[model samples]
Target: MSLPFKTLIKIERGNHLPMYVQIANELIKLIRGGKLTPGAFLPGTREMADLLAIHRKTIINAYEDLSVQGWIESLPRKGYRVVSDLPVIKPRSFQPKNNYPATSISPEELLHLPAFTRPGMVNDYQPGALIVDDGFPDINLTPYDFFLQQYRQQLNSGILYTLNFQKEEGGLLSLRTATSSFLNQTRGLNITHEQVAITRGAQMAIYLAAALLIKPGDRIIVSEPSYFMANQIFQQLGAVIHRVPVDEEGMDTNALEELLKTGTFKLIYVIPHHHHPTTVTMSTARRIQLLTLIKEYQLWAIEDDYDYDFHYRNSPILPLASADHDGRILYIGSYTKLLGPSFRIGYLVAGVQIIEQAIRYRRLMDIRGDFMMESALAALIDNGELSRHINRSKKIYAARLDKTTELLTSSNIPVSFHKPQGGMALWLRFDPQYPLANLLTNASANNLHLYGTAYFEGYNTNYNSLRFGFASLQEQQMEQAVSILAASLKKK
Candidate 1:
């Protein structure tokens, strides 16, 4: 099945690009055009050179380029063949007829392809600026030395490299085991490592669950002022979002019940422990009622307890999954709040079937999470270092939370907020006279960085509020930040 190479690949010697690149580009066109099918072996470099009347080295260079780009693979004594797993692509009739361009294509031209374009929230805090971040852990508080030591041990033991090549579907087995034990002890979840799938973060876990459960036009319920990023993911997947109001008691389960009666819903996204943007924990009564409704409606629930590790006032409530006997709840959690966001480790706890399917779906986007880091985290959990660090950080953040609350109360800035029992960040509402837009502009001028209230806005409602994160700020920094807020308020 040899093709006419000389006629198919038109060599333009007058073109400025290298001859090898020209040949490589022509072959790529053939492969993409379905002329050269997967597993089809290429002619020997010498044979190809003889056929094309070119230098053998040029053919070698072209093959090398193709191999590096993963278009073709080399087999021992078998020569080069196209990779078997590549998706079949139809030729673009819009492209110039058999005329390949010599110059590199611009990314701007590539952007014309049909794809979702959602920009992520960027953390662009400048150095020397006072910041009220969005409830992120202070990186300075992370036990990096201990974690690095464990990471180095994993590197030296050679387990990381072994696990990298091996297909450990969910994640490293050691980390999953450690995580299972840790959750059972701390959150009362009765599960094994087989029920867990490690993800890059809670965001990825949410995306994976949505991908598995939702279909186009399927109805899903979310809190009115829920995590916006999760809402974007559901919408992107073509799910219709129904918002239920969230008060101090948490997602008004009564309102949710009413909505459930009107239509069929596939899933519900709830943040029971310190609900994002509001910093309110769902009452025990509401949790019970919500769980009962979930069973009644046969709805799948994504219970995101992302910051369950840092409770200050009392012991945190056990996750909804702890009581789920029917495997209706998919629990999502993250280590980003405990170990700084840079760590990027999280997990989804569910039935073995869901875990297995989520792992398969995860492969489509990310092959696997960082094994070395997961192993190191497992060691940290086993050695009690992570628990100790969390205990120590809780006390410091509690004090910071108190100090910030007291200072803001005394400052007379026309602001009101309830001191949260747990989690990082305070939800503060400003007087309507003081627009959040103006306050943000004024704060920016004073070198004080604060997230705008736009993110927390609900459908057809504007709540002039912001989540004032205090965990990342020290006492003196909190004082300075409060002072800046007062000044911003006074600026007309």
Candidate 2:
């Protein structure tokens, strides 16, 4: 289909940026400069290419690239058009558009798109929907009104107004001290505030830690079939990630030791306390071995303690940091699973020197994340509200995990998993014959959202596993969710 593009763009073929990218950038500049208004139609690729004496494919490539990266849109028979939701980067000084209030953008353009493995199923499950999915708390247990009251009190307080752009290391007075005290009591690690760098969440903390340590051509050791997102992050940073296979006792220290002797690794990321997708905790002896290997190989051990707060059985073991003789471990934790996602608070505790370096890198990536929430978190900690809330949340999570595991075991589903002492996820390994592609498709048909096992180093192995977050599901719904999941795989 042919359409008209009225805008003009000057592309420099010799620029360091690629030809297509240069074209995209010029369009971006026009949009930002307000020369290209929203809803304006653009020229067809072949026509524009003919006018500019470039290949039709080049123009098409530029348009496709921009659309993919969330700049423009293509409508059938209407050529490319400037995104209606685009925000103009108005001139700051004396320009009327500078005072132009911020306009809205759609969820399609923004990065915060929900976790939709399938393109069209995100809105399939919703609050108050009649379905067996993990969305809200069990209405029978906690009072909705009580939580509202506490939240309202926080809003009325002075915490919201004083979101100072404090030290890049994180909030100093309230939250920092609380994090130190909480870790000391819960994890048995005696880290000072200076050693702790609070973050928007554990994911960001991991990114900062990885960025601080990793660069192009550096080697990093990871568990085979490990957390796909973490692997993706490390991969994006250009580090060569070496995947070491795991067993029932968390990360394979012996395999790592052998790998270390043969190759140099800049970082080794592990979920030692209760691993993701595998649900295995590293034995203390293995922990010692890992620490020894860290010193022997001179590599940084990044321990992602994502769900240590919820241990159903005996007390949760102190994380690797509790046993670190040297300052090589950067223990990470977050409150997303426990209280709620809105907290957006996570912390990394390391030696004072490492914290300093991480903060410098953090500032560059994003300056002072969620200052108001951070300050409120500090207040919550100082007043012991945070501790109390976590303790209560832990019991609730423990019950959910127990019920879910019991149900899965009773069903005799062709799945077996080591019950993690702590953590919210249940890592289920299907029979060797089960293929992930089929399971995902069938599961979605039954209105279930299941992720693959690759995130926990399950890529190379034929093991079919999935991590289920029990902390978020209603206790009654876990049985149904599991049954649907099990049936989906069986049918496939």
Candidate 3:
């Protein structure tokens, strides 16, 4: 039974396979080659670990694998012995030893793609860095444990039979129903589950709406200095985008009306509440005017209500989708921030016919969404747990927003910003005297992860502004960040 260590095995450290798996694989080869015959006793876990200079757990895992595969059996007091019987598994075709291309592309050819990349792609995560972001919620405040509990209870219950199959292309009926109820109460949209399609997130909902409403060469009106990602999406679809200047009132509905008179547009995309990147809510007058214009032109509108729940000041304005009686608006909202961005749960609200068409397009792109999580969200909504979480987090975020605003104002850095009525971020415009490069370099030197001004610099306009997100920062962090920003501004 004595075997030299070199003769018994050779371990390759550079291999991606875990040491335990490699050990099991080498042992399997020995067993198959009859070097270690059936009923031959093997070394104990401790003996193997010592010989290989690895943790005993590795050897134990290897033994467990061998036992599960019918390769070996453990005796009462003795070590593992090779099994007498084995299952027949046909050998797979031989794979070439040559290095394959990293991508699934031909060696001689190059694949060209549109130069489209995600907006605000983080190049690196610097530890202990304070980030001024484009309005994201504090996911750390999410009720993750409660949601996990519901998921676990459902998984352990008898309803597993129902959830195992594909439910509906529109998504879980329970979630759709729950979303309908929530929207009816909060956003003033009276809808049924049939009028909604659940998507991975609001981005997917935007994609679906665009795919359904827009054709190549179709004109779509959007706000200048609007969401970069939304413009990118429209560009990818070969749609011509017309930008209307946005001021304190939000997307010049007057300009939009003028554009409508001049030419036909397929659809209009608007962020009515806490308008993306700018953090400006559409004035009540503009809302009514925009609604009237859309109705008259029969132009479909995509209203992105991504951060509707985080209103801190006066009550939120009723969504345009709520007042659209002529089927002119498609409302898109996301629970991704409430549950964390990784939980890609969003809903699109439109006429039942439009929803049906969107479902078709959704099926072509993604076969279905996460049913189990959707169902869990439904349970949260039904019991009012989701509402309660929102109510609680809303207050905490409001305080954080106040603290961030206070810090920025006290910094005296010559930065001007409108005191936002609601939402998790402030739209800060620097004085033209301060160079953005100087500000960015100083911010980076102060350990603040400041993204460049690409987000504010849209196709038609370049505003010296940035969305200074507040929800994710604590009071101390906010103070530290503002102090650093002030210091950056003071330098030259």
Residue-level lDDT of model 3, residues 194-257, one tens digit each, is 8889999998898888777777798999988777777877887778999888888888988888
Model 3 off-target regions past 4 Å? 1-123, 451-460, 490-492
lDDT tens digits, residue span 177-242, model 1 = 999998876777777898889999898888888788888798999998988788888887888999
**Best-to-worst ranking by TM-score:** 1, 3, 2
* TM per candidate: 0.74, 0.69, 0.73
Which regions of candidate 2 are displaced past 4 Å? 1-121, 126-169, 451-459, 490-492
Give the clashing pairs for model 1: none
What C-alpha lDDT, on a 0 to 100 scale, does residue 228 get in candidate 2?
Answer: 67
How many steric overlaps are in each model, in order?
Answer: 0, 13, 0
Error of 2 at 488 (Å): 2.3
Q: Which ten residues in a row have the lowest lDDT in candidate 3?
A: 99-108
State the TM-score for model 3. 0.73
Candidate 1 residue runs with Cα over 4 Å from true position? 1-127, 452-457, 490-492
Residue-pair clash count for candidate 3: 0
Overall local distance difference test of candidate 3: 0.75
